[model samples]
Target chain A: MTTGAYPSQSTARLTRERFRAGECRPTAGIAPGMTQTNLIALPRDWAWDFLLYAQRNPQACPVLEVTDPGDWHTGLAEGADLRTDLPRYRVWRDGVLAEEINDASACWEVHPDLVTFLIGCSFTFENALLEAGIEVRHITDNTNVPMYRTHLPCHPAGRLQGEVVVSMRPLPAAHIARASTITARYPGVHGAPIHVGDPKALGIVDLDRPDFGDPVRIEPGEIPVFWACGVTPQVAVMASNVPFALTHAPGHMFITDVPDSRYHV
Target chain B: MTTGAYPSQSTARLTRERFRAGECRPTAGIAPGMTQTNLIALPRDWAWDFLLYAQRNPQACPVLEVTDPGDWHTGLAEGADLRTDLPRYRVWRDGVLAEEINDASACWEVHPDLVTFLIGCSFTFENALLEAGIEVRHITDNTNVPMYRTHLPCHPAGRLQGEVVVSMRPLPAAHIARASTITARYPGVHGAPIHVGDPKALGIVDLDRPDFGDPVRIEPGEIPVFWACGVTPQVAVMASNVPFALTHAPGHMFITDVPDSRYHV
Candidate 1:
């Protein structure tokens, strides 16, 4: 449900309650002003490599918080249990999708060496962009943000190595500078746009057919702006072929207690 | 040797040459415009906890780069061997000071699981402050910057936990604003001052005495400015009492290839 229908704090509580009860749905447009996070849980043996990967490629994987081995609670939210806080989760085994589940507690219990990482999501900055009078077309159209795989190679860390993945938002040519300036303040999120124009330069042959998410129309005089997507790490993790890994489904995020403004410089 | 005697680039190379040749000395003012880093090497088993500790307490441990397991080469400095590039090293065993040596290669070789971490140093921001017309009393007086053990406890991660340590710089009341603004741009370093005017606010009793480093004179009109020190991670790592750890001796840092200006927003 959209945050407009409920009070901000109660909306977040309601979202968590729904998720805990196995109500599987996307988390977009929920808990306005509250930060949402991309979740990744890996075995303790593989966590250090992923942490190092995030450190090396911060633009793509801006970590908000990380839990100790086998811990599910994060300081980012009060009484938020990571095992059941997200609306949906993607379980991977040997770099392949094993199953989609609403509750990951069973999987987590089996692998007691799991460590959770709360990574900053672009949705936090989208809220700021909306407040600044910049239109986030996906939110306006009530659809998933368009994302594409780029040729830009991320710096390799241990066994985690892959090309960067980015989300696209088409904006008017005039709003490009203001949008970048506004988002640059929130480096805790994905930060500013990585590319302003020419998807071809990023090795994306077709803007209308995205590798992930629904493609949005680019009207006359509007340019597609690309920001590093949280998917980059997920893709890298999958490519690394770890024995088992879990991540929040696309558009299905873990809502955090941290305000969006906290990330603003 | 001070950087005033050679060109900036040559000075960095010269400093590294001397360090590699076993010229044991403090690195302050040796490469004026270049960035210097605090080094910490820990076994792979403990590296995850240390990485988590650094992530939780980024202000105190702004990690510049973390090497893979048993790796010592860092991209921060080209051909700068982490094993011998630093003028001095402190070997810790069971959290106690084991020995001070000019080289840590032998120690690292013995513990093949060692992973090196290069953390940002305040010397980079100090250079920025000096360029902005702020006086760094320690550099002017040719003494080590004053550091103190504050009552501010760091957010614990895994087995690592300790009080936050701060390096004090006395700035004129009028320059505090500018110094903070300038340093805030460089979050790679300690970012802005954590505390501004009063020493007692941070549980620091006397300005003339410090827990580490030589105390500097706090002038009559100067306000004591405190920035989170890199020594904090070392303190926490020591307190964790890991089997073996290695860190750079105070003021004897690893000279990085990155320029100070790169960190500026």
Candidate 2:
């Protein structure tokens, strides 16, 4: 999912251009310096609920940009068409996955009043973690990060309500603090780890079995750290049985022109 | 508007209790350690525009908490009724001031689907400034902080559109940086000064005659520092000619049970 090339701004544009030209791939490493976001497009009627939900649970759903209803442009990415710029998209009908596609133009035609939200993805902080000398287990293994559903309830907003879903990365006990301090600088991304050292604490029984993405190797001296994942809004959409929705496929995020440093506090 | 005597958590609760019983006074000094907020309630249909407007112009309209439609309870204050707890309220009808009153319960009866938004106020950070030994001019003068509607345009969201509004404070040139650094820690509370030194830069011709609140003396060797003010949203509501709205009367803000330190980043 990561190229580790650390593309420049122009390169970031080129990556999105390629995606617009029908190339599909995970966006983590392609634009390391630029920001990558989790995409969620909800109907105009459901927009308020999702926006309020994100506002309430900022740690899990830090909104980078929310497009006006029926608008596909975001200020974060210049000259980028959100409908076509993402490498892959998932269209949902009545809370269930309808189909996975490379372009969402057809979905917009069916639901023109969709309001798109570009939420901060934790992948934005992975470069900082790696630079701080901490191993992001999923990136190190060249695989999608492990994620789990938890019992933690997010503050309900209007029609949207669901439990928090968290992504896991096993860090050596010594590097845990450094990893936290590094990621905490970017609250626009998922800030620091929510819990560390116990899977039971988050109500997970097995380390190897993840609800989404592939499981990674957890070394003996490593502690499992959990972060509020961007997938939370999708979980909420599903739980609420939203009539129609669209989201970026897991690990295949929307790469923006905004530099990761812009979100740094 | 400031009391200088920083109160504890219990005093904060007592203060709200008094307001709930119809005590009408500015909330500054009554709960110095607790958070203060700017209240704006709009009909459910207009809620999306205002929420998106706040999200886009965070510096001027930092949202603390937003209530569900027709709901008056805020999680920021436990058991505090939004309709009755505040000292005063301004009822707006078709973008004009319809009336000013001590309680908004009657107004809610007419507009049952109003969604209330609690916004961050600069008063929440004034205590921190004073504790750091920086003299806050408005607090020193016992006046409402002077606010101005700037020529700077806010990023429009849906139907809401207006310019940035700023609160000004004159500080000794040496203390300007310290004041900025101090307030920058509380992003939820308007964060830092948007401008310094020149009032002309913000299109203000006179310092003595402020558009809102009272003017403070700018001493020799002192420079005027400007911060994004909570009034920006009211300005937007007026500019957009919103059919109906409710806001706390200027200087008479809603005091929350949450500590001022809780907003510190």
Model 1 accuracy (lDDT, Cα) = 0.85
Give residue A83's error in model 1 in angstroms.
1.7
| Per-candidate local distance difference test | 0.85, 0.86
Using lDDT as the measure, the top candidate is 2
> Which 10-residue window in model 1 chain A sums to the lowest lDDT?
A1-10
lDDT of 2 at A68: 85
Predicted candidate 2 versus true structure: per-residue lDDT over A1-265, tens digit per residue = 2223344777888988898889987666666777899999998989988999999998899888899889998888778898999889988888988898988998789989999999999889888887887877777777888889898999898888998989898988999888888887787888888999888988888889998778989999988999999989889888999999999987788888777887776
- Per-residue lDDT of candidate 2, residues B27-75 (tens digit): 6656677899999999998999999999998888989899889999988
**Minimal lDDT window, size 10, model 2 chain A:** A1-10
lDDT of 1 by residue, A109-200 (tens): 78998988899889888877888788888888878878898999988888889888999999999999999998877777888889999899
